[model samples]
Target: MNLFTDIRTLVIASLDAMVADGALPDGLDFANVAVEPPRDAAHGDMATNAAMVLAKPAKQKPRDIAEKLAEKLAMDDRITSAEVAGPGFLNLRLAPGIWQDVIGSVLAAGTDFGRSDVGQGKKVNVEYVSANPTGPLHVGHTRGAVFGDALASLLDFAGFNVTREYYINDGGAQVDVLARSVYLRYLEAHGQEVAFEDGTYPGDYLIAVGEDLKTRVGDAYVGQPESVWLEKIRDYATEAMMDLIRADLASLGVVMDKFYSEKSLYGTGRIEAALDSLESKGLIYEGVLEPPKGKKPEDWEPREQTLFKSTEHGDDVDRPVKKSDGAWTYFAPDIAYHYDKVTRGYDLLIDIFGADHGGYVKRMKAAVSALSDGTVPLDIKLTQLVKLFKNGEPFKMSKRAGTFVTLRDVVDQVGPDVTRFVMLTRKNDAPLDFDFDKVLEQSKDNPVFYVQYANARVCSALRKATEVGLDVSDAATAAADLSLITDPAQLSVAKKLAEWPRLIEIAARTNEPHRVAFYLYELASDLHGLYHLGKDNADLRFIDEGNSAATQAKMALARAVSVVISAGLGILGVTPVEEMR
Candidate 1:
């Protein structure tokens, strides 16, 4: 069903044929040869760099290779014309029946049309939105959550065994602050006034947790000092906040496969084990790092510390694992965590971090590389911040969170589907401006609405066809005489549909789900363009009034578009609206 792959297979076979005939060298490497859509659609259906890539290796000119390869491809029934374009690129025009076959395949495959096996069932762990359990998830976490969830889905669609995870930062000083903050709320629930200091969380979202704690142990911990109740309340507060976080993620249609606790790495030999793994390889040592790279030496002081030789693995400099005071640095627990992931036998590890953690990527990768002995690869994707606007003005803070907009604020406002789509409109590494007013508009400018409207419009056409007593089942539509769909506009949509399987492999390989959003937008644009053209040209209409057979053929194309749209939106965690409100 992957037309591009099929054609590429043919192109490779042609190159091998040349090798066998001694027309080209015997030992030629064709790994880099690729058959993809031509940059200019007017050129041909596909363009291959086979001739150019094999030219220097085969000791043959590119044009000579392409001209020879073109004749070989021309013998295939699928290729209508294999022309030598430019120097060595072979532009291939596929037979029209191939495009028609793509539509029938889409209708037959339903939402599974573009599913791929590029991942080969490799085990992968995607860790994201590891926000501290201090409050509700904020705007930044919202973007990470959507991006991570969609990425997990994309990897799954591409045949990766994916585990969605969240790392809790409950072992840090932040959770102690959370415990103190909740104590104030607990006092307030007991009819005593309380004030939130600079270090405490002042959000009103914890009021319920406070009241519930009061109901559980009424006045028991009221008179206790910090030592007596700190540990107990810290556990209680972290668990409560995690529950709140789970609710927020559920509202956004996100659910993690596992929740890892950073505290578990403490009071245990896990940190030592992770370090020992590196030390055994001569990668860990005690040393004083050079002072700040660009700073004056007079302003810097060097202290001997236990450090990991991260520079050997690709980091810019060696990183500290334990400080001079014999206390583990923040990087130690992270190292232990990744070591655990490696020992668990995952083939790949992916961490989705906020843009603010950009500097941490190199060290994390080096740690994993050392721990896994270069057997497992790690990819860290940093999701940039989201700037929210309302009616063209910058969005304000949330009262519930008391400082930033919470995930609930967005899910409650736009609903989960629109919020997820808008979050993915931009690449995860690029800053996104989410205008509440703009995303909700029923216009082409709003990708969320535009894509949904195309699906709903297709449903309307199907319903109207059904009212005329015409069979609109998928089987009937797929079995229609698709050759009747000869219009350039109708065929343009089929061409886009044919690109689905190819797009899946590319997007999955890049780990960029934004490409799915972009493709869906383009497909929607093509569908909408054809629908509008029908207004001026009667032949372009989806449902011909006089002939049921013609209408069915066109409906096959429309339904095929919807099938792919639904699949793309589903991969994006979006629900296609059946009818526009």
Candidate 2:
């Protein structure tokens, strides 16, 4: 069903025939041989570097090899012509029927048209948006959440067994601050005036949690020491904050398969067990780290500590696992968490972190490498900051979140579909500017609107065809005689559709779901371009008057475009619009 793949197979077969005929030498690896669209449409429909790649290896001239290969490929029915270009590149013009078949394949497969088995069912764990359970998620976490969720969906479509996960940072000092903040709110709920100190959270969102604590215990911890209420309130506040975070994610259509608690690693021997595994490999040691670079010897203190030989596994330096106070360092729990994931038997691990955590990437990867003995690979993607603009100026902070804009703030303004689509409009590592006025504009500059408008246009065509009594069911459109779909404008759309399967494989392999959004925009452009051409040429219109056969043939192409758009948007976790208001 993949036209490029089908053509590549033919190209490879033709090369094998050349070897048999003594036109080329044997044992030339074809791994580097690639068939893709020509850089210029004026050159040809597709281009292949097979001749150029094999010429030096086979001890033959590139042009000579290309001439022989072209003759061999000309014998195939699918390739209309193959011509040598430049030194050894071969440009090919496919038979028009080949493009027509791509349309039929799209309709036949429906939304599963571009689904690939490139992943081969490997188990993949994607951990993202592991923000501290202190309050509702912020704009930075929103980007990570959308990126991770979309990546999980893309992997699933590419045939990977994906698990969406969230690692809760509950067993940290931050949670204790949250508990104290809630305690202050609890006093206020008990008719006592309280002041939120600089270290405590002052967001209005915690007001309800404080009131709820009053209802549950009726001020049992009132006027008591921190020892009596700190632990209990820490647990209670974490649960409440997590509930708020879940609702925020739900607003954006994200649901995790697992929520791992960092607290579970403590008091459960898991941290010790993970370190023990490392110790058995001679990677653990008691040593003093060198003074950090740029520090004077007099200003630096050398303390003996328990360290992990992280540099052996690609880190910049050895990392300390335990502090001088005989307590676990911050990196200890993270190492244990990854060790736990490796023992769970996942083939791959992907972590989506905010841009500020870029320094943590190497150490985390080293930990997983040491834990899994380099058997499981870890890929960490860092999502950069999102700058919001409204009314031609930088958007202000949310009052409810106190310091930043919440995820719900963005979603409530533009709704989930626009929010999700706009977040992915840029690469994960590149900073993004989310302009409220621009994204909502119904114009070509707006990718979300452009893509959605294309889908809506297809739906409008389908409804018009139905009114005219043309049968446009899936089976009927798939079985329509596509030979009449020979117009240059229509064939261009089919050519774009042929790239869907290849696009999925590439995006999944690179772990970049933003490429899907980019591809959808290009496909939508092609669809819209063809739709605009039909205004002047009646023959190019989707519905031909008084000719059922011609109308079905044209409508089939329009329907096929919608099928691919739906599939692409489905991977992005955005619902396709039937009509754009």
Candidate 3:
């Protein structure tokens, strides 16, 4: 059903025929030959660089090879004409029946129209939104969460065995701060006044956790020192905050396949084992790290520390794993954590980190590389910040979350669908300005609304067809005589639909979910254009009073648009609206 792929196959077949006739050199690698849409739609349906790519390798001029290739390709029934454009680019015009058949294929496939098998079911691990278990998730975490979830879904749809994971940051000093903060709230629950000092969390969200602790075990640690209660309260507080984090993710319709606790790696053999694996590979050693050339060095002498030879694995320099004091550095657990992932035998690993973690990318990749002996590849995608606005004004931060807008706050205002869609409207590495006033508006400027409106319009067409006593079921529409859908406007939308499977493969190969959003918006624009054309021309309308076959053909095309829209929205984790409000 991929017209581009089918056309590329024809192009390759014609090139083989040229080689068979001695018109082109044999053994020329044509793997780089590509058939894609022309830069300008007015040029042709597809443009291929086969001649341009093969010219130098075949020791022939591009124009000469292009002329012969065009002649060979014009023999196919599917390709109406092939013309040589500037220095050997071949632009191809497809037969009208091909576009008509694309609509039929979409109807037959339904919501699974664009699903791809490009991933080949390879095992992939995607870890994202590993926010600290100290409080609610904020705006930046929401972007990563939405991006990560969509990416996992995209890979799954692309035939990858994807596992969605969240790493809990409960092993750090921040959790200690959370524990003490909860102790303060616990004391307040005992009818005693306690002030939140400089290191304690003062958010109102923790008030309930403290009250819950009071309800669980009252009067047990009221007057005790830090020794007897610290560990107990730390575990208790970590669990409570994880519950809060899980709830926040649930509100956004994001579900994780695994929640890996950083604390579980602590005092466990996992850290020692990961370091042991490196040591066995001669990657671990005791050394001193030098500072950058331009930066002023610290007023201290070199000290022996356990380090990993990350420089050999593409990092800028070797990194420390253990300090002089014999304590594991922050990098130690991270190495061990990723080693655990590698040991589980994943073909690929992807981390969705905030833009602030850009420095961690190279070192983390080096760790995974050294851990897997350069077999498993790791990709770290950093999501940029989100600046929230409403009515041309900056949105205020939530007092409950202290400094930034919480994920719950954004989801509650706009709902999960709008929040997820707007979050992906930009590239993951670029800053996004999410305007509440603009996103919720019913105008075409709101991409989410526009895409949803296209689906609703299709449903409206289906309802009208059914009202006229025509069978609007999927089976009926798929079997409709599609040659009746010969209008240029209707065929234009079908051409766009034909690009869906190709776009899915492109998005999956690049590991970019935002491309799906961009493609859906473009497809919706084409659908809207065709629907508007039906308004002025009665013959272009989906329903015809006398001919059920013609009406079914037109309605079939409309439903195919909705089918692709639903598939795209499914990957985005956004609910498709059958009727826009």
Candidate 4:
């Protein structure tokens, strides 16, 4: 079904034949040989660097090898012509039937057309949006949530066993602040006026938790000491905040398979166990790290503490696992958490962090590497800031003004589909400007609407064909004589369709979900272009009005495009529109 993979197989087989004919050396490495679309579509449908990669290795000139390879490739039925372009690049023009088959294959496969097995079922743990469970998720957390969810879906489509995870930072100082904030709210619930000091959370979202606490305990700890109420309120408040956070994630269509509590690593021997594993490898030591370069904290001085030899594994400096006060540093719990993931037998680990955590990247990777002994790899993706725009003007977020945008605020405004798609339009490391006016605009510039419009138009075509008594059922399209689709415009769509399987592998390998967004935009463009062309050419229309065979052929293409759009949107977690409202 993957025409590119099939064509590459033929190319490799021809190269083997060349080896047999003594035109190339025996047992030459072919891993670098690649079959990809040429930069210019007019140059060819596909091109290979086999000749260029093998030329110097085989002790032959590139053109000399390309000429011999061309002679061998011309014998294949799929490749109509193989021309040696500049610097021995072999550009191939595939037979038109190859493009024809791509359409039929798409129709046959339905929405499952581009699902790939390149991952071979390796277990991948993608941890994202691990924001502190202290308050409602803000706009900053929304970007990480969308990126991680899309990445998990993309990896799943590429055949990786994906586990969507959220690491709850409940064991941090922020949760204590949350506890005190809720306590103040609780006092207010008891008819006491309270002031939200500089350190306390002033958002109205905590009022409910405070009232619920009053209902549960009914004045039991009304004027007690900190010891009596702090622990109970901290636990209750943390759970409530987590419940609210989960709902916020649910609003965006994100569901995590795991929610790891940072508190769990505190009471148990988990931190010690992770450190012991590192100690056994001589990566743990009692040492003092030099103060950071340039502007060191004035209070910072040489202090021997529990340190991880992260420098050996490529960190800028050896990092402390324990503070001078003997408590575990924040890095300690993180190291143990990733160690637990490695021990759970995942083949790979991916962490989606906010851009501010860029400084934590190297040491985190070093810790995971030391824990796993480099057996498992960790890829940390840092999601940059999302700037909001309203009416083409920069939108402001003010915590003191109590006008901070929550994830719920965004989903309520645009709905989850538009939220997810627009969030992914930019690369994770690149800053994104999410303009409210532009996203809802029903134009090509609005990718979410444009892609959805393509799906809606396909549905319109099918409904019209049905009205004209054409057999446009899934069963009929699957059984249609797809060979009748011979127009150059029709085949151009199928050629774009052929790139899906390859696109999935590339996007997954690069951990870049923006590629999927870009690809869907291109596919939607092709579908819309083909639909607009039918306005002038009656033969290109999906509903022929008289000839059932021609109508089936056109509907087959339209249906195929809709199927691919649905599949791509599924990866993006967007529901395809059946009709535009």
TM-score of each: 0.98, 0.98, 0.98, 0.98
Per-residue CA lDDT of candidate 1, range 1-581, in tens? 89899999998899899888888988788899999989998998899999999999888899999999999999999999989988889999988889999998988888999899989999999999999999999999999999999999999999899999999998889999999999889989999988999779899998998899899999888868999788989999999999999999999999999999999999999999999999999999989998877756786678999999999999999999999999999999999999999999999999999999999999999999999989999999999999999977999999989888999998888999999999999999999998888889999999999999999999999999888887877778978998898887888889999999999999999999999999999999999999999999988888776888888898999999899999999999999988999
Computed on alpha carbons, the lDDT of every model, listed in order, comes to: 0.93, 0.94, 0.92, 0.90
Off by over 4 Å in 1: 296-300
TM-score: model 1 vs. ground truth: 0.98
- Point out the worst 10-residue segment of candidate 3 by lDDT: 291-300
Candidate 3, 392-483: lDDT as tens digits: 99999999987779999999899999999999999999999999889999989999999999999899889888988988788889899999
Which regions in candidate 3 have their CA more than 4 angstroms from the true location? 297-301
User: What's model 4's lDDT at 536?
Assistant: 99
Task: For candidate 3, give the lDDT of residue 341.
Answer: 100
Per-residue lDDT for 131-247 in model 2, tens only? 999999999999999999999999999999999999999999999999999999999999999998868999999999999999999979889899999999999999999999999
Q: Which segments of candidate 4 are over 4 A away from where they belong?
A: 396-403
Rank order by lDDT, top first? 2, 1, 3, 4
By summed lDDT, the worst window of 10 consecutive residues in model 1 runs over 292-301
Candidate 1 lDDT score at position 8: 91
| Model 2 global lDDT (CA atoms, 0 to 1) | 0.94
Q: Write the per-residue lDDT of candidate 4 for residues 385-447, one digit (tens) a residue.
A: 988889878876644325577898778779999999999999999999988889999999899
Model 2 poorest ten-residue lDDT run: 291-300
